[model samples]
Target chain A: MFEHTENINNEEYIPETYIPTAVSHGTKELWQVFWILLGITVVDFIIYFAMGASMTRNIIFILMGLVKAFFIVGTFMHLKFERQFMILMIVLPALAFIGMLVFGLLHEGNALSIDY
Target chain B: MSTHTTVTNTTPTWAGGRSPFNVSYGKLMMWIFLLSDAFTFSSLLVGYGAIRFSYSGHPVTPWPDPALVFNHFPGFHGVHLPLLFVSLMTLILIISSVTMVLAVEAGHRKDNKSVLKYMLITIIFGSMFLGCQAWEWSQFIGEGARLNENLFGFTTEAAAKAGNLKLFDHVHWDMAADRTPGPVPFASLFFIVTGFHGFHVFSGIVILVVVYINALFGTYERRGHYEMIEKVGLYWHFVDLVWVFVFTFYYLI
Candidate 1:
């Protein structure tokens, strides 16, 4: 294990001047993700206006939403850079809970449906 | 003493060590907080869906169509622009998220100038989004949208036929069954969900401003890392992500 105290005392480990990057691979990657998200949103908008409302169309919209969400979470949040366990620990549980909410609410909605 | 020494717990549980998850503790905690907040938002949205969809039981219930209600754009009076303004709002938020991520990336490289620049842009974008939302809310209120009741008529046909009916005319209210709870659930849910989201956006803007000031003052530079930017970037992205769902549920669908 690296010792923080030892590292603090090590002159070689210390950089006297730190200059952040104006353009780096990470920035380029961020732009790529941004464009992709923009593309997805535009497609979703086109679909939204071009097509009439239908179950299939709604599902497609939602799936595209999920896709956009995945990218934002993976890249913007930088979850992809984290350990897999950390990713799963945060994502899986929240997803499971959200799934529960969707299903449970769907059931409730049906129960409250006048047709029912 | 035994010939072979037995090793007990070598490190105290509270003792600091390398991050087990290979991420900073502050960043990890922020993620956890965001996850919990995600649950909070999901619950609110689900509740909105349940109540909003549940109104299917009533025939003459009035639920205003989001498309028709949100059609007005700034300086375009009487010109309907379905999803245009809201879409613009989404784009602005996404752009801000992009700037925020850029800020984080700059932080990673220890580029204080870039971090400050990107963070400033992010804050500007966030503030613009909030301004748009405020305008949107005013439009809703100006158009007689309410949280507790439906000012619009119940059925367009009924309202048209009955000249005395003030609430549900074709010139005003769209074809929705206005009875019982009427548009109460819809209005309340709209206000609640979007209001909560608006609060989050406002908070994000404030945080970004604070972070921007810090960046300007060489706070993060002195700390030798831009982890604050990364943490706040996570929050800003989360806000944008929630808006995606909100736009879908409240506007599109």
Candidate 2:
């Protein structure tokens, strides 16, 4: 229960550490992102059944997954509102690591395919 | 210090007091942690992919068909539903993430009532997803799948040749023990990857429950900013995003 107080100058009363400066994402924007994510996921579910198994389907699934990941990180995680430097700091290293894994796996596959 | 003489009034470079990213220390650290965690997951998934693609076409036991393997829907009683339940679980997780973001938005507006309400909703949704996951795991184990063997008949040489393996047939439960200790990477990888992700979901639920209790106690109200909620929101979204990858590799692929 919060105490009721008159319009007293509470500047000195409030603790410095208690300052609230979180960026306000509008309610409408939040809902918009939510809908976008749900729609994409539904489409993803549908595509699996529609396309069955194929190299193309696998590629499409990966691309669509990246798209969904982008939306979740950009909107729900609030990465879009963050500064460019911060975004680069996170995204660049992650991409680099993923690239390394992909290329490394490809090389391994090539070696495995060759019979002695 | 007493002997030091001031040259310029400007702040020292070493001090660098301001946040380089214009964000709080807690948030910056959370991002770093998530990035490292992302690498860990990527490595595991990539390793699974490598092993699977290499051996899928080989004469050895083929990778198990995810559709045939995970076709159990709760309470449907022997009904075969390929990916219907997992997709529903994904949707629930995404919905929980939406509620989490809404809670952060409410916190930004300093609307304590809305924040608490949204946080509670998010926690409920997260709990539901975990419940579905537990049921799915139980079905898999009950069907005789384990780390040692792929219970699915198609994952064995003889069954692959016979080509008449029914999904979730109780008769084949003994067939798992009959098969030689062939390459069952599918079973091992399925358990490892999903197990790790399940652990994350479990921990996320625990953290969300704690956050919900704090919200009920009006702790965030006193703190003036629900940065804690925002941080947890980052984690929840990451979990949701990771599931996208898991669903793609484990189910769709």
Candidate 3:
């Protein structure tokens, strides 16, 4: 609580060491983090326009997308700083749903009945 | 039962000057709520994916081409502008997240002015995002756009082969066009769920404006600190995170 602000005359603004990532806190390299974010976005754009077969393009994008997502969630969202149990709680359901999605998308075309 | 008081540690002032990332209780609770809200949206979308599975078959309706649907932006002609509006929405959300962080910074410094400034910016961005969605909904639901009525009738499966354009524009109504839809089906579900999420963003903006107003009046200065900013910021970030999934599953897919 800042109950002592009135007594301190608000003269001293406490310098907070902002923590965005899970890494050990020290001096912040703000520019470094910004550069990384910009770089990843550009790469994503490039991959979208790159001339490649659908499968190849999709595979590359998926992998790169996961990496980018990890950076955003870990650094930007600060989820990386959370406990392992928190991580599992956040990730497990998504993984499960994604598995079902992939399976249904791939197999249903062949497996679905046509009697209707 | 969340209190707005900022945490005070008895471990002296030498410990990294009050951990910003230590995260307050209110923020954590907001996150937990957001997580539950996330599952609700995903279930709605994934369920939409499954039930609308054979869009090409049954009472076939050609869906509208989402790209071709909103290709105009007041001045542009034939822009091929797919995903443009949504892309801007994504950027706006990102920028709002940045502003929210700035507000949190201001809260740490006990600077009410900067706190109000950043919170106002966040409110403005949130409103704009919702406004964009309103435009999209108008363009989609207005003027004969059907969830199940295409030129091909029930051959939507075949129509889907023609491309994403024809698939979106066409829809096939089960009973008669005049008959009321029975208990809100898939298309209804899609709009309702995403609409509800957008409504949350809308409400969050209102709450943020109230918090900003309190900050402007120097309310927090009187009684300790402004943890409301932190709580609201968490909600803002959660909104951003949810949009990522919505963009991926609903729009991109």
- Per-candidate DockQ values are 0.30, 0.28, 0.13
Q: Kindly report which residue stretches of model 1 are placed more than 4 angstroms away from their true locations once superposed.
A: A1-25, A114-116, B1-17, B152-154, B158-181
Candidate with maximal TM-score: 2
For all candidates listed, what's the TM-score of chain B alone? 0.83, 0.84, 0.70
Order the candidates by DockQ, highest first — what do you get? 1, 2, 3
Residue pairs in steric clash, candidate 2? none
CAPRI grade of model 3: incorrect
* lDDT sort, best first: 2, 1, 3
* lDDT for B237 (candidate 3): 68
How much does each candidate deviate from the true structure in C-alpha RMSD? 7.9, 8.2, 9.4
For candidate 3, what is the lDDT?
0.57
Interface C-alpha root-mean-square deviation, candidates in order: 8.7, 10.4, 10.6
Tens digit of lDDT per residue, candidate 1, span B1-253?
3354343434432254333355656777798999999999999988887777766535566455566567768877756577889999999999999988888888878899988888888888899999999999898777566888655434555444334422222333333443223557777788889999999999998888888888899998888778788889989999999998998888888
Residue B60 shift from truth in candidate 3, angstroms: 4.8
lDDT of each: 0.76, 0.77, 0.57
Docking class of 1: acceptable
Model 2, residue B196: distance off in Å is 1.1
Q: Give candidate 2's error at residue B177 in angstroms.
A: 12
lDDT of 3 by residue, B128-194 (tens): 8898888776655653334542221223343343244321234323323322322124446447766
Give the share of true interchain contacts found in each model: 0.46, 0.49, 0.04
